[model samples]
Target: MISRMFSRFNISIGSVTHQIFKKPTSLSRSVIARKFCNEIARPENFATAGTMNDVHIKMMERIGLEPGYSPIPRSREHLIQYQPSSADLPPRSMADSFTSAVIPLSSSKSLQDLYVSYLGHVRFGRLMQDMDLFAVWVCHQHVNIPNLDKNIHLPYTFVTIMVDKIDFTDFSPKGTSDIRLSGHVSWVGKSSMEIVVWLEQEFEGTYKKITRALFLMAARNATNTGPAPVNQISPGNEHEQNILIGGEERKKRRIDHQKMSLLKVVPSNYEQSIMHDIFTRITRKDTIQLDKRVLPANGKWMADCSIMNTIPCFPEHRNAHNKVFGGFIMKIALENSWVCAYLHAKSRPKLETISDISFEKPVDVSSFLQMNAYVTYTEMNFMVVMVVADVLNPTGGRMTSNVLYYVWKCNESVPEVIPGSYHEMMWYLMGRRKLNYALGLTSGV
Candidate 1:
């Protein structure tokens, strides 16, 4: 039965692609194949492995043991040093960390019900959550610490620092085919790893690409107290070497972008001119009066296109480290931004791309999370929405947790968004930069 299931799948690692027809004699040798049997066939097991703690608990349960029934001491004192050098661990190949999972939406009614949206299209936000989880799992596969007992829990904790980008194609799933999630650890730094994951759906006996995502993750100690060292990546072939080079370029771009942030530096001459043009179009020059700005025809004020939502971070949404799951926060932010775009366009919007998402801080599990979404920039049918997530404290103070940017495309052209204040204009410029990046344009209004 396992062999029959394996015959229908194709796995790609770097530039190499192969089909596995024979089932592995041992489950440890083929984690993806085992995942196909345990997770694709039974979606309930996928839900059980949502977090690392859950994964460990489920494994214990599979061995006919109760929860917290560990024979070895799961303490920090008994194990090796908390911080291991890179030399202490062996370098891993890109294929060594490659992993894949299947969401059989076509065969499983329950999965379809969970992933399909009201418009009969698969929910992109839910897929973002899955991608985030899959990236972490791939990193775990790459990391191998030395002198650590197998019976005890892993001493390293992987946390997502940022998502470099998520680019989507025109292919949309109709809930009639199985979706495959595959990725590998493409690059590794001293303590950080770059994971490249892609999504595809089975179509006419072939897999059609849906989207690709790049995630940056950092390793921390078991208690989430400090940085932990991770294994290095050994590029085995030319294709893998190119992937490593791309990762280096991405890291460089991120640094350059930070150096040019609006918060630190003034806007460029071109950006300032664009802002001036919008100001002149909306303001009356004849009067020397305050508040002379008036909304132009076919224009919507940036502040007016705002949407807000508040959610309580429950324990169920916490990750293995008892902090709010980064994926949950991403899903919420995307949904909020989608609503903002929908209201601004007065039509259902299709997500074109999600720009770089940086997790500023981890939210407490019991905190109240608030999200503010604003349509900051628009060009014809494309709208750039920014979602700001903050954790609200009991004393009425809030700390920024995340700032996400998304680009949405409507069926028809939408009204232009005009910035009224200086801060709004900054947001407008930032939104334009993000939209340009998403659209693969170097410069644009």
Candidate 2:
């Protein structure tokens, strides 16, 4: 029955062999790919604004730092050669990178106020920001740069390239239970590492699983100039070895999925048939005019179901390198997408999965960030929301910085979303592919 449901999508589920990397004699394909992507997808450089307001002052005070304090290092006197070889670094075990932190939501009312939504439930979007931060911390734990400055930031900067997947089993979090976040580096290539994080809540002296996230991060030079080599990791035991293997499979799947993107390839016969069926149901046979189309009883036009927001990127949300944090951008995007899903579903939707989020460019502080989110597709109780974030310039130009995709499930069935144009139809198909991969109906393209 499950297979039949996905037959029209032309999807097949399967697995491939895991490729483990030993100490490399030369640069690997992954490293070369990363370099090529970075060259073409370089972020626009914006001069840092010196404007400081009352809000900025307060934030600085709260963090026990002065307004003039910059997290960026003042000097590179601690000399280290650029682009170190991967084989030069020593191998570390997964256990060496394991890190954990507890959010004392149950004990601190002040903290709870920041995390709890008006609906009296923990905000999943805020949790996503924390998870992203935690994933970077885990990567730091795995990195062992010899003789680097201990007081200053590491000679390398770890940035999130992709959020492969975030799956939620239990979205509800009680205010009385403390939330714990833990993870380790599951896989490593020369210039990339995969960090797997777990979100759990305490109940009756036990930790119950809530969700698991896989983050793919790439290392760059401290100056944000180019790709930097990362240390290699070896599995310590059987379970850890299994995790390493899984990471390899995910990497392969990501490559395959990109190659099969709708922009790069035409739709298959099965997908075309499905799209035709949708068109037939929405249009009247008596007329050829698109204006004469009639929507299904519970259908909504995709164009009418969108939401947009403009936000000022402040320095308070900036990372150590002084750029707006990727995690902060993610939190903002998720909340906007969640609201779009709610309006489309006519009910509070639960986040089922974050299939993929790509950070194409770095967002600078003191810039205006704009986000547009809309419901692209729906099936039964599931909704696929896409959020596109761009940086706005004073000249009225826009540069796309990030694209995020989310899968949400509601308690009841949602209104079917109908595509009104060719672009929207492509978005519909892309959403379907994301949903299929998230539900394990497909092994990915």
Q: Which stretches of candidate 1 lie above 4 Å from their native place?
A: 1-83, 443-445
- lDDT (10s digit) by residue, model 2, range 1-445: 4344454443322211112223234545444433332221111331111211222343233223444535463443342353357766788877777767777787778878988888677788778888887887777778886655444445666789989867788647776568887777888988899988778888889887788788899987766667788888776665566667666767887898889999899887766766777777777878878667777787899998899999998777886457788889999999999999998888989999898999998988878999999899887789999999999998889999999999999988788888987799999999988887777555444
Q: Can you give the TM-score per candidate against the true fold? A: 0.83, 0.83
lDDT of 2 at 126: 78
RMSD of each: 13.0, 10.5
lDDT (10s digit) by residue, model 1, range 165-202: 67788888767578888778877888899888778889
**lDDT (0-100) at residue 274 of candidate 2?**
63
lDDT of 2: 0.75
Per-candidate total of colliding backbone pairs:
0, 0
Task: Give candidate 2 misplaced runs (Cα > 4 Å).
Answer: 1-84, 149-153
Q: On a 0 to 100 scale, what is the lDDT of residue 243 in model 1? A: 70
lDDT of 1: 0.75
